[model samples]
Target: MSVSNPTLITFVIYIAAMVLIGFMAYRSTNNLSDYILGGRSLGSVVTALSAGASDMSGWLLMGLPGAIYMSGLSESWIAIGLIIGAYLNWLFVAGRLRVQTEHNGDALTLPDYFSSRFEDKSGLLRIISAVVILVFFTIYCASGIVAGARLFESTFGMSYETALWAGAAATIAYTFVGGFLAVSWTDTVQATLMIFALLLTPIIVLLATGGVDTTFLAIEAQDPSNFDMLKNTTFIGIISLMGWGLGYFGQPHILARFMAADSVKSIANARRISMTWMILCLGGTVAVGFFGIAYFSANPDLAGPVTENHERVFIELAKILFNPWIAGVLLSAILAAVMSTLSCQLLVCSSALTEDFYKTFLRKTASQVELVWVGRAMVLLVALVAIALASNPENRVLGLVSYAWAGFGAAFGPVVLISVIWKDMTRNGALAGILVGAITVIVWKHFEVLGLYEIIPGFIFASLAIYIVSKLGAPTAGMLSRFAAAEADFRLNK
Candidate 1:
C-alpha cells in the first residue's frame, strides 16, 4: 500500500522533532560522561519512561503481539515473565547499581563497572565484557533495524533494502549528534507515543469487533484453543517462556538508565512508574493480539497482510481501523519504538568501545571533547554494522532479540547481581561467571538442548561459577572496603 499523505506527513514531522531534540541535547553534552551517561542527571520520570521504552523496544509491539496472534494466549507467558523480571530488577538492582557504579570509579558502562567492581588491574574483565556487549548488541541493534525496515516496507511499499536504510536513518542521526541525552529525551516522547498507540489501538479493535464479549465469542468460534492459555504448552515450554525474566538483570541499555539516574533516591519512584507503564503496555499488547483474532476473523477479506506476516498485526490494524490522520499518529508509534531502543543500543555499543576500549587502551590521555566525538563516531560505525546484519529481509525481530537478550542476561546478569549484593564474589569468580554464562548460552543455543531456553542454563551455570570460584579465593581487603562503602551509601539513600 502506498503511504497516505497524512501518514507521510506524520512520519516527516516525527522524524524532524526527534532530530531537533538531538540538537537541543547537543548543547548540554560537553564531556565523555555527559555524552555517554547524560552526566548522571536524569529525573525519575525520564529515567522510568526511558528505561521502559528502551526495554520494550520493537518486540513489545511487533514480536509479542505477533506471537499471541499466531499461538493464542499461551504466548502471554513471555509478557508475564518480563513483568516479573523487570520488577525484581528495579527492586534489587536499580538503586544498588546507581550507588555502586558511582562509588566504583564513577563507571560509565557495564564493562567499566565490572572492571572497577572487581579491581581488574589486568583489564581482562573490561575487554571480555566489552567484546560480549559488542557481539550481542550488534545483533540486538539489528533486531531494531529489522523492525524499522518492516514498518517502512509494509507502510510505504518500499523494497526491503530501501526500507532498511530509510528506517535506520533518523535513529542514527539523533544518536550520532546528541548521544545519551538525546536518546533518553527522545525515549520519553517515544514511550508516550507507544503507550498511546498500544492502549488506543486495542480499544478501537475491541469496539470495531463489537465488544469484549463479542470479541471473545468470535475468538472462541474461530478456535477454542484461543482461550486456552496452557494449550499445547509443556512444562519446559512454560519455563522457557518465563525464563525471559532473567534477562532483565543483564540488559545494558536498561541498566544504563539506572546508572544514569540523578540519584539512588530516585529509584523507588522510578520503579513504581516504570512498572505501572510496563504492565499497562504489556496488557495493551496482549489485548491487541487477542482482539485482533476476532477483528480479522470477522473480516477475513482484510486479513491478507497479517496472514502473511503475523508480526504486522498491529501495523495492519492501525492502518485499517483508524482514520488516515489518527492512523498516521498511531503508526508513528512503531517508529518511536524502533528508534528509542535502537538509539540506546547504539549508544551502549559506542560507550563500550569509547570508554572501555579507546580511552583505556588506545589513548589514556584522550580529552573529554575528543572522547565525546569518538563516541559519536562509534555510534555511526555500529549503525553501519547493524544495518549490514539486518540486510536480510528474512530476519525475524523476535528471533534476533531473543538471542541477544539471552546473550546479555546470561553473560552479565549473574555477574552484575552478584557483584553488587555479595562482597565475597572475587574477581576470578566474576570472570568465571561471565565466561560460563556466555559460553553456556552460545553452546546451548547452538545445540537446542532440551528445548529449554539458553538463558535458563546460562544463568544457572554462571551463578554457580561465581559461587564456586569465589569460594576458592576471597576478595582483597580493598575490594571489601569499596563494597562496604557502596553498601553504606545505598543504605543512606534507601
Candidate 2:
C-alpha cells in the first residue's frame, strides 16, 4: 500500500521539530548535570507532562486499547490501579525525593541516592542497582520499540524489520543529541498531542456510533459478554491488575522527573496537573477501544484489520473516521506516545551508565564535557540493544511492558519506600530487598502456577526482606544521621 502524501508530510514535520528541539537543548547543555537532569530546573507543567508521557508510553495508546477491545471492561482494572499508584507516588515520593536527593550528597541517579543514603563504602549497592536498571530497562525499552514497529507497519505498510529501525531512529537522534532537556521538552509536546488525539478520537468514534447507549447496545447485540464489566473478574485478577501501581515507585524515568523539578513546592502543582491528564486520557483510551467494538459490529466485513490485529484499532479508526490530513495528525499521536517514552528510557539508561558506572568507577576524574558526551554515546548504544531485543515480530507490546513493569515495581518499589520513610533502613536491607524483589519477579513469572500476577508475590517478599535484613544488620550511626538530615531538609523545603 502506498502512503498518503498528507500523512507523510505531517510525520516528517513532526520528526523535524523533535530534532530541532534536540539541537536547542544541545546548546543549553553545559555540564553533565544539565545533560542528565536538566540542571534541576524543570517547572511544574514540564515536570508533570514529561513524567506522564514517559510513564504512559505506547502501552497507554496500543496495549491498553487492545486489551479493552479483547477483554472488555475487566481490563480497566489495570488503569484504576495505575491511577491510585501514580497519585501515591507523586504525593509521597515526588517532593521527598527531590529534597532528599539534593540533601543526600546531591545524588544524580537512583543508584547514586541509594549508595549515598546508605553510606555504602563498598560500592555494592550502586553496582547491583545499575545492573538491575540495565537488565530490566533493556526489556522495557523493547516494548516501546515494538509499539513503534506496529505503528509503522500499519501506517506506512512497511516490513516489520524496516519499521523497527525507522521507529527508533528519531528517538535515538534527539535523545543522543539533546539529552535530558531535549527529552523533557519533547515529552511535554508529545503528552499534549497524545491527550488531544485521545480526546478527539473518542468523541468522533462515540458520535459515529450514535452515542454511548446506542454503542453499548450495538456491542451487546453481537456478544453480551462484551458489555459485562465483571464477566471473569475475580478477586485475584483485580489484585493483580491493580498491582501495576506498585511499579510507579521504582520507575527510574518517572523518578527523574521529580528529581529535576525546579523546587519542592512545584511538586504539588505538577501532581494535580499530571493526575488530571492521566484520568482524562485513560477515559479517552478506554472509550476508543470500546467504540471499536461497536464500530466493528456495525460493519462486520470491514472489521478484518481489527480482528486480525487488535492493536491496530486506533490506527485503522484514524484512517476510516477522518480526512487524510486529520488522520495523519491523529496517527502522529501514536508516534508521539512511542517517541516520548523511548527517549526517556534511553536517557535513564544513559544516566545509569554514566553517573552510576562510568564516572563513579571507570573515570573518577572525567571532565564535565567528556561525561556529557559519554552519556550521549551510551544513549545510542542502549537504543540499539533494545531494538535488537524487539526484532521479533511475535512480541506483544503489553506483555513485554507487563514483565518489565513487574520487574522494576517489585525490585525497587519496596526499597525506595523504605529508604525514604524509614530511618532505620540499612545498606544490607536495601540490597536484600532489591535482590529478593527482582529475583522473585523473574522466578514467579517463569513458574506460572500462582494464578496471580508476579508483582503481588514479588512485592510481598521484597518488603519482608528489607525489614528482616535491616533489623539483622543493625542501622549504622552514619545512616541514621543522614536520614535525620534528609528529614530536616525536607521539612525546611516543604
Candidate 3:
C-alpha cells in the first residue's frame, strides 16, 4: 500500500508543533523544579487535559477498542473501573498530594516525597522507590513505543524496526529539550485531538451503518453472545476487569499531574474537566470498537485487519470510512495518544533518576543547570531501554500496559493513600509496603498464580504489609509530630 501524502503531511505538521512547544518550554525553564514540575504553574485546563492525555495513552485509541471488539461489553468493565478509580483518585488524592508534596520537604519526586514524609535518614525509601519507578516505567514506556510502532506500521507500511525508532524519536527529542512544560503543553493539544478523533469516528460510523438499531443488529447477527456482558465470564474475570480502576491511584505519571497543578484549588476544576473528558472519550472509544464489530460483520472482505490484530480495528475503520485527508487526521490522533503518554513516562523516569537518584546520591552539590541536563540525558537513556523492549513487533499494547499498571498500582497505591490520610503510618510500614507490593506484583506475574489480575493480589498484600509492619515497628516521635502537623495543615488549607 502506498503512503497517503495528506496523512503524512498532517503528521509532520503535528510533530513539528510539538517540537516547537518543546523549544519554548526549554527557553522558560531555569531550574530543576521548572524542568521537572513546570514550576507548579499549570492551571485547571492544562492540568486536566495533560493528566487525561498522559493517563489514557494509546490504550484509549487502540487497546480499549481492541478489547471491546474481541470481547464485547464484558471488556467494558475496565472502562467503568477506570472511570470510578480516576474520579476517586482526583477527589481524594489530588488536593492532598498537591499540598503535601510542596509542604513535605519540598519533595520533587514520589520517592523524594516518601523519604521526606517519613523522615527516612538512611535514604532507603528513595533508593527502593526509585528502583521500582525505573523498572516499571521502562516496561510502561515500552508499551507506548509499541503502540506508536503499530501506528507507523499500519499507516506508513514501514518495517517494524524503522517504525519503532521513528515513533520514539520525536517523543525523546521534545521531552529531552522541554522537560515537564513541553510534555504538559503537548498533552493538552493531544488530548483535544484524541477526543475529537474519538467523537467523530463513531458518529460517522453510525451514519454510514444506518443507525444505532442496525448497528446493534449487525453485531448481534455476527455472534449473539457478543451482546452479553457476562458471556462465559467468571467472577474472577469481572473482578480482574474492574481491578484496572485501582491502578489509577498509584500511577506515577498521573500523580505527577497532581503535583504539578498550580494550587489545590485548581485541582477541583481540573477534576471536573478531566472527568467529563474521560467519560465522553471512553464512550467514544467503546463506540469505535462496537462500530467496528458492526462494520466488519456487514463487510467481511475488510475484516483482515480485525482478524489479524484486533487492536487495528480503529486504524482500519479510520482508513476505510474516511478520505485520505480526514483519515490522516484520525490516524494522527493515535500518534498523539502514543506520544502524549510516552513523553510523560519518560519525564517521570528522568525525574526519578535526577531528583531521587542523581542529585540525592551522586551529586548533592550539582547546579540547577547541571541537574536539568542530567535529567535530559536520563530521558534519552530511558527511551533507549524502552525501545529495546518494544523492538518485538508482536508485543501487544494492552498486555504490556496492564503489567506496568499493576506494578505501580500494587506497589504505591495503598502507601500513597494511607500516608496522606493516616498520621500513625510508620516509615518501617511504608518501606515494608513498597517491598511487598513490588515483590507481589513480580511474583504474581511470574507464576501466573491466581488467574486474577496481579494488581488485586499485589495491592491486598501490600496494604496488609504496611498495616502489619507498622503495628510491629517503632515510630519516631518527631515523625509522628510532623505527620500530625502536615495532616492538619492540609485539612486547614483545603
TM-score (all chains, Cα) for each model: 0.99, 0.98, 0.98
Candidate 1 global lDDT: 0.95
Residue 14, model 2: lDDT of: 92
Candidate 2 lDDT tens digits, 198-311? 999988988899998988898788788976767788888889999999999999999999999999889999999999999999998988888888998898887887898898
Q: Model 2 misses residue 150 by how many Å?
A: 0.6
Better of 1 and 2 by lDDT: 1
lDDT of 1 by residue, 1-494 (tens): 59678988889899999999999999999999999999999999999999999998898889999999999999999999999999999999999999999989999999999998889999999999999999999999999999999999999899999999999999999999999999999999999999999999999999999998999999999999988989889999999999999999999999999999999889999999999999999999999999999999999999999999999999999999998888888889999999999999999999999999999999999999999999999999999999999999899999999999999999999999988899999999999999999999999999999999999999999999999999999889888999999999999987
Model 2: colliding residue pairs: none
Supply the TM-score for candidate 3: 0.98
Quote the lDDT for 61 in model 1.
86
Model 2: CA > 4 A from native = none
Relative to the true structure, how large is the alpha-carbon lDDT of every model?
0.95, 0.91, 0.92
The true-versus-predicted C-alpha distance at residue 83 of model 3, in Å, is 0.6
